[model samples]
Target: MPASLGLLRALVLLLLLLAFLDPKWPREGRVVYLLDFSPSAREGVFALAERLPREGIFLAFAERVERLPAPTARRLDLGERTDIQRAFLEALKLSPDRVVLVSDGLFPPLAPPFPLDALYVPPKPHVALSLLPPPYPLYGETVGVGVVLEAPRPAEARLRVEGPGGVWTRTLRVEGRKVLPYAFPLEGEAEVWAVAEGPWGRSEARLRLAPADRARALVLGDPALARYLEAQGFQVEEGPFRLPLEADLVAVGLGVLDLPEGAPEALRAYLHRGGGLLFTATPRGLFFGGWDRVLPEDLPLKPLGREGAALVLVLDVSGSMEGEKLSLAVAAALELIGTATPEDRVGVVVFASGHRVLFPPRPMTLQAKKEAQSLLLSLRAGGGTVLGGALREAVDLLKGVPGGRKGILVLTDGQVADDREALLALAAGAGAEVSAIALGQDADAPLLEALARRGGGRFYRAATPKELPRLFLREGQEVFRGGALEGRFPVEKAPHPLTEPFAFPPLEVLLPARAEPWAEVLLRSGERALLALGERGEGRVAALATDLSRSWRDFAGAAPFLGGLARYLAGAGRALALYAYPEGEGVRVVVLGRLEAPRLLAGGKETPLLPAGPGRFEGVARGEGVLLDGKRRIPLSLPLPGEWTPRDGEATLRAMAEATGGRLLSPEEAGRGVRRPLPLRPYLLLAALLLFLLERFLEARVPRGTLREGAPG
Candidate 1:
């Protein structure tokens, strides 16, 4: 209450409030040297880091972060997976006056706290190679092989390709931080090698290809069907019903009734162990033969067969189809007959000046297909092109048939010089799907395309004999699907490992069957699965109801479908790859897929391929042979590691520095060091307490009434 007491309290309050300021004295400066230790950084980065002034503290980072007590020149072994933001946060924790990052700029872009600067270390001079995608592509037609080349400066690169077509090379100049990319389109087996050799250093990379593949198919009990399988690009081998066969696919034409002979059971055993089999019907109706006891009922089959269509083939044996054209046409027809179901009624008509029915429309049994083939082979070519008479005969063959599924296929090499309008009229009156194929350069293509368009069928043309058979089979699909194509049921693709790179070919004839509970249905048409894959014991089995007898006529995705199916059956499902890229002074090899302790082999030596992640293996290759896993051989070569490809991250580092109100510095600019602000709050609090005690002592010494209110400084 006294004046001295009030003044002392005011002074205490003032001292306490000042403690909250906690101010500090400003000094010179201090810096934290943030260094990149990734493999991508220049080889001299470590030595350069050590040469910086002692005024700055050192911090190093790559895929990981660490604070260094002293500068050192060596690898941190912290992989190329850069985390700049994380590294920046760690540098801020050191509480320096400023932080300077010394790096090749390979680290990802980052936004740092207020006190971060960059001492950009340009990337080491080197040329490296890598594939565009980490994985290799499937082989079929022309497939593009992608290449990536990274260089610090303009590099002279040479690319070489060796394959079924032999070897060729090309040279070019590549530059800058952006990768120089190139793609080469190839078909069949191919191996490629690339080299970038110049003043910067010599770097190399190569691509290796698998051997050419052709599936071996076995045909049991029917040589007639053996020829049919060969047309599908398979290597066919006829059999006397033997076991332990060297075949990827097998077709059984015998009735299941002979199961007691052990042949059917043996085939079933083969299927169980991973062999592919088609329990196809012969000329005679397919007889299950009471073999349900030995064969699994889950096998997708159509014992009753499909209701078939009526197809008429009107062939032109005109003078134009005299030599190779006529011979190929006959061969094409022979393959065509095998596509029809036994229930389908098929007829063959030949025309030149006049027309004659070679084979009348009847059930297409095994005997019928053979008989048609024989009849077609014996036919001779002569006279002018006369299509009207052939159309009349074909119409007559389909007269009794319903309009729903009747078909007329007209083949010709010469233009219709006689009765063209009459033939068109006859074809229209038949109320059937009429498809046509015009052969050779002289054939009338417009008329054929128009006929097919009007009749709701696909038109085909074969400028060469090579295209004849495929066109024939594609027409079979229209006839098999019924007159106007009532939209055949769409095939449903199910998720499965076999469905990798999934696609469906245009299916012509699919046997209706049910899948068992354990069976894996990969493809389906309506409720019945068209293709089913399963593993029973030591082998794999596939039930493909879609008739492969139907040839392809440039149907999109069909070739891949067939190729993939054959490869899958032939033990190609395991995805294992070995790839090599430069890593620092060595070559880093990567293997994808499961394996135990895999290794990289080069120049007859082996190096351990260590586990890097789940399903991924990595290691360093010793030399350039690039062979590993006893199978794959990658031609890996590079003068420097691939991690140095993008050159440097100068732009990214500069942006981060500018964002934080910092300047890009050099390794020599390490003088920015000064201790952080010193706290004064503790001293101020102590002073306030001492003042309070002094005020209390004075009040006690002066008696209570003597403490009077007065203005005092």
Candidate 2:
């Protein structure tokens, strides 16, 4: 009876201990934390992550979307852009039952593939500076500037402009997000600033202004093209591609490749010295193909043929190419033949299970053109595609052709049983290039590209039959002007400074489309953005949506716009030299020129700047600003905060929280309500002591001699 009582006491003690010490398994759902690693979102992300439970939480950097190591610091320095959508999609693949996201909500929100919780950091107050008109005004010209303020409530903003004359200040009332335009004559270099006092406190933005300079342009093409540059205040100099020492820009015309031996190297050196080059050539110009090494490494430009070529049109007439593909292919070939000059021989080869020479190599005489057109119209699609045989026939036809360059333009709608490597080797051996046109989305793109690369020719793709003609025209004729763009698209006001005076007649873009993260959309067509501008390294790039061809119909009045864009891109070579950016709580100055020590002049006092890095200096400025680099004065400005369009992300955060079945709270509220790690050591120790006391008490009460201690038989 005594032993039974002891056992009951022990059982009660174990139950109490179990209740006090709660245990969890590793397999339990983890709270995966996906945080933006962008510059402005880093601090807030880390702060929120630190306050959350550590055991069940996992850390993933949203920039690259990978788990941070155990020794990851509380916060890290972030500079590059973040792809939030890609990061979220990756996080969902981990199949975490719960997720937490933190960001400043500056970037666009993409639909989540899966549900998750989000905590948004409040946006910091700031102002934006925008140049409104006269995007490329002459020196000492007056231009209109727009100032935008983003604040929580009504506020008074102080505006100032400091230039060759002196400092000018004005006061204006603003609420929420407001834009106030101001006109200022830019005399040499200038600086503009706006300071606003709002509910979130004081916010400021500074902008450096420099009127466009009259460029000294060197022209290598027909002097007629020089008229365009001359209209843009350029002192045109006619010469070969042998870049002159005084030339600020070089414009090479089509078929101009005879450089004075080391000229390309000299041009490379010139680019490093802040000189710019513009090549105007057909998409197949030799400049784009062989001279790419002279251009910037990150330049998103395609290669072109380096010399005039005797082009053989190799066409696929397989059964698969019957419908629209065959029709487009025939039309594209005719267009290419029309573009060939009398000096360039044009030939045609059609293939199905076998190859047939539709037209032998010959100059495009009037009679020859008619004959080619009639032959193309009569052709019909049938049988299987043997690409290798067609390529071999085309290469053989170009072997004896009298031309400095030789290549074949192959148009195919589908893959075929052919030895691709053998075809490439044959083309190479015959000293011929092979360009490929992949029609329709199902066309073998990688295969075509490989053929082009191996044969040392350009590759083109037609997403639909409608694009086949344009693609052919782009590649066949001298259309791609050495990556130069010319279009008359009417520009509605855009966010980028490059498109400040964006106003053009309604027109369509004809070039291939490209999208880079760093690029800013400057113009749009309905919902499709047409003109995109960006800066890479130290050079500026402008990508247009349409092909800028004489066939664009609306390009008659676009000369001014095209010239302005060219000058803008050329001047961008110097834009990076005098740039100022916001760093932490101050403005950092980056100059390309040589200087011993740099100091910032603000509000009549000098603030010494320490060397931040190579060719960079850092200092704080409250109002209008200027920089003295011992040799000369450089205007300075802080980056406008609205550059990313930061906003209060409460709505998005709430939506995400509800989607994932999680609660929404501010940082302060989260800190107060979030579960803290429970310490079980004390509770466990207390339970043990209580159990021991109970055991002693029970033993004493059991009467030592009266208790029977025999074992059960």
Candidate 3:
């Protein structure tokens, strides 16, 4: 053969030889397709499978292989609902190079099944942002909107607001693939239409403003009286008189004035609207008649005659009153004293830097009257004004004063102090009216007006002390008259059903009404007990007693003491009522009605039985079965096991099965009190075998090759 040709032929032969002994290069790229086979996911899975590459591995979740498509490189059909975590474990065994998840975004939180390089295929109509407050309070109050977005990566969207008002838009920058929060501040009582426009589509929400403030009022007289009705901070306005209108309260003063032209109609309207009216009038027949006509027929006002009532004159002799005011005040005090009855008590308080009680509370005898007159004449104005202190001291002197309606007539001529609230409190404590006589140019009219209102007394302006005498002596009549007998009774401690060692307070008794009363005594440790009072002759005595001066420091005068006494008389008759009871197993089951059965659930089955007596039950339980109509079956093996402890040893026996997972039952559940078979170990062993086979198969197929290897062989 020729050498060159032979060489060429040899080269060809060498190439053929090399081809015969060829080392195949491995295919490095992998294709992994994950299919979801959940009940609602079938259509999506089929669509994904149709679009998937035929040569790639196929994994179907929540369904078996017989239920899925063919032509898969490596097919894995999962039976039952897909466990995302288990699916990931199975996926790692296959060790695919490329991975894809095909389903709706609603998937369980699964461990990473594949590397980060894997591709994820999400289905369409992917809820970009879903607003979730449906059937919400819209257009009436506040509304909340929840936005949910579906995306593999974070999305930035804007919420475009549109409604009857106009268009306003705000941008929402979402960082992760989830729902985001945004709040809308809607003000006033207006309806707002809202729609959230995001990357996907628009979600609608409606917001309606709640009712603003609808509070109405009805004033009996001129709306001017409504102006004075400012205690609860309500806005006052004038309106025609109508009966059935929504007003808080009505004030009728100076009695001569008729209800406005529509006043009768307004009064009817007022009553229908739940209105309360306060009527103030002098004892004059003309004024009283006018005042009586305006009041509701149910509350008739009666007038008491002058001359038999107890009255105390309280005069303020501060430095601002160094002239004519002093003389008038002294005369007023003497005249007021002269009107008092022999049985009526009279006290005088003259205040300058501090208060000086001219005469302590004493009956109106000639000597007492004479002494009071002497004290009034000796009054000297020389110190700084402390009207609040004087008012307080005057009230203190009237403590235990003998009068149904006790009061102090005050005469002041300057802006003494700023303790009006304290004076009001002292007046309330004494339950006494404080009539004020403002004298001179320095007298504060507003302060006097407020003082009169707070003390439930009348305000009069007197230019000098001479006018003060007339003002004080003119209102010498009492509206109500009654004597108070004050005394204290000792209390003892007793056991209470709901509380321990219930202690009572020292109680006062009022005469003429034999009433039983009760009081709530609060202890230092935040516990409370009720103390009852028994009926006494002509009055009622509370079992609990406390010193009026010490325990009830806020209540100082006869009226307040009598009021407390009346309350005690009303509450002592009723016995304590049992509200609830305790039940078995440290469980406090409420006693709904009279329980005729035992309160305990007993026997091997914890059967509920009828109680033989109060809070006690009688029943039997044989085994582990709960009582149906007072009888229950007990599992045979429950009480037999050495490790099992019988809840009721006398009625139950514990037994153990040879199978590792079998549970011992009490004889009652066996029906015939016989032991039964429980096979659990077989299932456990079968599961173990399955796991071992799976591990072996995984070990045999997964990569054992090192990265240094050029290719997989």
Candidate 4:
């Protein structure tokens, strides 16, 4: 049989098969209209309905999906939420051959079951800032709250963060999708409000600020620490030293055992009655003073074991540092050397017209101490002072040694030739700390003070050799007591009443001391205790090996740490909190602490917050007002609803139609019913038949050639 004849027979057989399948042409049939009744889509739905084909079936959906009898002027209230997917899925159940969706396209894109067409309504461009849920904060703390801001373009927005401390207003530039953190100062009462407004949009969130109660404390000897405690929400009264009978805490500064006439008695009574007493550590208090007498015998603190310390002493033997000044400097050096145990390594750097290392860091053994004293006694004052050079040499010597608690103590009676302040600042990052002592009146007090502070060590000033104490020396020249935790170190908090998720400030004073067996260590530096607590009879007692300067007067971060500590001492726990924020079209209220009865008052309506679980409760409310729980009233503002969340919905509509083999329709096309997808089987059958006939004609007309088994044609 010829190939063309065979192809013709095959085409005839395929044509019969195509006819049997019975493919239909494009035509509108059994059409269904899925209408969006959501608030964002309502305007587009009603307007489109007037122009939509009345012959088609109609279904309306928002919170509920249902068939509509007809397009009418009356609007049905099916709640505010828009559910486009639900409406489309229901339309398929009706066996519609074609589905047309009318909406603003504000809902998530949906892939319809049948060929779908869409009439889109676009929403206006909007900007909004939604605050994340806030946490129940402690008194005197800054709550860092996150807010998400969305805008089509950059917006200059004004934000107001209000607390019991007062309202703080901030102006910032905002753009598309940025998460910003705002710190709200929580004061005596926990009620905070954050409001952001701009030309684009305005959003405000209110927190149920129910901060813990303020702690009452009696502070003696240290008003700086007292003031810092106040910033952290402590009611502090500076004193006559007589512990108030109702006081929750008492702090004695400088490790002074010399209590006012009735103080010791009052303190003992206070501790016995379950009050808290904080005692500082000092050499005078431990050796010369009455630390043992003040604290309970059972709560006695032990001195730190012999731990190695890296000591570098810089001395100036200039013409100005002659008789008494030189002697005093040597005496101070000797005292510092005495404090070091056999395990400690000590180095001495002396400068005259030049600087030289008298001795490198070596173990302070019996012979080493003797050799150091002999070298110091033989030193003579001469030439100009090279104080800066001496310090450099000392730091270099310290670097050679390894370990924590490394220090450089400088004894200078004259200013350096270079910028004295810059010279001291240079020592800030050399791995070791730099402390300075001014042996005479001419010494730069400010320069040395700066050096000591930056080095995380001590600065002392002496007018004459007489100012040097006999037994003990402390920072700032006034001495006698050696603090147990007596330097700058990062404090570690243990789980206790005195701790929270608090950002603790840098503490400058801590004595190397251990807590008593009866004491529960609340704070630590390395393995040593920084703050410890014990109880006796009805009273409580605390031992602070640090200088106990929770003073915010200089350090900004001191407030929260000390405030939380003072609050715990005053017998305050985490207080009840009521949180309310805008979610969707309504407000969500959450209760933090266990409350017998919690209620929200908003939009002139009162609603009770139901308990969800242990220490957790929640409910929903509409509009704005205040949340009330017992005597507490926290302001509330519910912002954007979910249906009103920013979205143009145009892309969603186009995508949905394209996904289901449909098209986005204009008002004119929607009125005539949606266009159906053209059938492909008819085109396939016609192309196949025509190609077969063409193939036969080409074969009959064109020249044909045949090749033998091995011959080329």
Give lDDT per model, in order.
Answer: 0.64, 0.60, 0.44, 0.65
lDDT per residue for candidate 2 within 1-713, as digits (tens), equals: 56766675776678566756664333445456666776546655665666655444445553566565431344554345557777777777777666667666665555566656677865444343343222343443345555655443244666665444356676766555555566654545666665555343565666666765655677664354476567555668887555355565665543323445456556556555555655443332223323332242433333322234577888888899897878877886786676554556788899999999998889777789899999999999999878887787787787777767666788887875787677667656757667788887777888888888887878988888767765665555432222434454454547654456545556543333333455566666554445665555444554444433432334344545556666665664433344444443344555543345777788899988777765455566654576775654655544433324434457656765676567566665433323325455566567767767777787778766666444343
For model 2, how many clashes?
Answer: 14
TM-score of 4: 0.40
- Candidate 1 TM-score over all chains jointly: 0.40
| Candidate 3 lDDT by residue in tens digits, 72-145 | 33344455244444545556677755444444424323335344222223332212433333111212122333
Candidates' RMSD to native: 21.8, 22.8, 29.7, 21.3
| Candidate order (TM-score) | 4, 1, 2, 3
Expressed as tens digits, the lDDT of each residue in 170-276 for candidate 4 is 78876545556666556644555777887756777775545544556777666666877776667788765653555557766633334544455666766664566
- Model 1 lDDT per residue over 630-664, tens place: 45444444333345555347777788888878777
Model 1: how far is 179 from its true place, Å? 7.9
Query: What stretches of model 4 exceed 4 Å from their correct place?
Result: 1-16, 20-22, 25-27, 124-131, 144-183, 188-207, 211-561, 564-641, 675-713
Best by lDDT: 4
**Candidate 3 — which residues are off by over 4 angstroms?**
1-308, 478-713
Off by over 4 Å in 2: 1-213, 222-225, 243-246, 254-256, 272-274, 282-299, 303-537, 541-560, 575-713
Backbone clashes, each candidate: 16, 14, 61, 29
User: Which candidate model has the greater TM-score, 2 or 4?
Assistant: 4
